[model samples]
Target: MTDFITTELHTARCLLRPWRTEDIPLVPPIADTRAISWNTSLKFPHPYGEEAARTMVSWSQADAGVDKWQFAVFKDGQLIGGCGTIRGEDVHAHTAVVGYWLGVDWWGRGIASEILAALVDYMREETDIEQLTATCFGWNPASRRVLEKAGFRNEGVRKGVVKKWGKTTDLWVYGMLL
Candidate 1:
């Protein structure tokens, strides 16, 4: 995957693009705060600082070609959240893991679904990736619905696969094949 053909991506209400320094301040607290911690795989104690965001921006840039990317999800000219793919080492292979999260305040407004849909379209058109996979805690019905609505099919549970806040969690695996 030389790149995901990221010239531009547009959803009905959002735009996805590369991250910038300006977006740092907006992203940290959302990850640090307890509001969205459990819903994401982001490491905890996000520190709400510039360093982390810079690191992320750098990674997104350096890894852009191989299916690793971080697109800033925006609406109304504001940073709403971030979404991207964690490209597998095999570029010619048609697959990658997808992950994303919105600010707590932005939840339940169809934003996540919209973003996911746009990403799916972009991936299908921009790369040879035939499979996009995602995981969500079993108890998180909202996330499950979002993935299903985005055309992901439920696979199975990975029991006790994630440990957050000192508790083990079972994750439901889902995938969409193009």
Candidate 2:
């Protein structure tokens, strides 16, 4: 529960750093795809616009430096996606839920898997979190694969856990206990 400096996290393909005010404009274009929103939680809305971008950036900026757990993913100086961790409180404070997304153009390039593995390692080595978890829509096999490749084990599945786009779906939960 004490502060630990995070600075920037890096993978072979990209850099994960704190969000900036300038990134607000760049998010809408990359995040406005139904394909991306379909697999993610409702928090990431389809037709993602400037207002949503502003909210995302504000959340990242509100936290302390390097310690800002949310990160903007950049490759070659351009924003390509984003990732972050949400730590649980109370009895689950040692656990953190992880999430990430890449632009459609960045898909099939293994960027998410690469950055995700790195993020897990960073959190394990740099922070107080001891358990990391991620959940994907059961129909999203690609995301399930990414989580597996990053060393997460499928914990279980919860049926009727997510209602998105007017359809109810199962949620596949994955976790890594460090």
Candidate 3:
């Protein structure tokens, strides 16, 4: 049997845990929002549905030997969003790229910052990663602020690197050294 690192992380106001099969239904509405997808990677479909959510949950559960960690964000026992890290391999093995998104209802509440801070601390303490990085769309100031407040420093911008909503935009990179 493969040993999997399935763990739950907690913050002052939220719990970050693995996605459950029952959580599939809650994902579609929150993840399908245009506002959430605008700042996320292209892999996050705009019209997220049960199938996508199921695929996500399944993929997250499966261990293919890579150091990828994903968790569903929960507040007051309710699923609010998701966050995770894609750890690099070989020469970049000490680094990982983190990403997160919250439902519209949870915006402006400092939940994102809290989630990142907790996840960063957990990764540093529990894993071998030395650096955590994140990318935010140039048009999304809220995400940028969240990363900043979580102690990530602005690295630089990649011009015209992402095409979303029929427009090509720059991506601001940020990194935190653990």
State the lDDT of candidate 3 residue by residue for 20-93, as single tens digits.
78899989977888888777777888788889899998887775225777889999988899998888888999
Q: Say which prediction, candidate 1 or candidate 3, comes out ahead on TM-score.
A: 3
C-alpha lDDT (0 to 100) for residue 3 of candidate 1: 43
RMSD of each: 2.4, 2.2, 2.3
Clashing pairs in 3: none
Can you write out model 2's per-residue Cα lDDT over 48-115, one digit (the tens) per residue? 99999998888777754333478899999899999888888789888888999999999989999999
Determine the C-alpha RMSD for candidate 1 after optimal superposition of all C-alphas: 2.4
Question: Which residues of candidate 2, in runs, are more than 4 Å off?
Answer: 1-6, 64-68
Q: Identify the runs in model 3 with alpha carbons over 4 angstroms from their true place.
A: 1-6, 64-66
Each prediction's TM-score against the native? 0.88, 0.93, 0.92
Ranking by TM-score: 2, 3, 1
Q: Write down the worst ten-residue block by lDDT for model 1.
A: 41-50
Global lDDT scores for all candidate models: 0.78, 0.86, 0.86
lDDT of 1 by residue, 23-133 (tens): 777777665566676667664244446677777776777757455756889889878788888766656356889988887778999999999998888778777677889
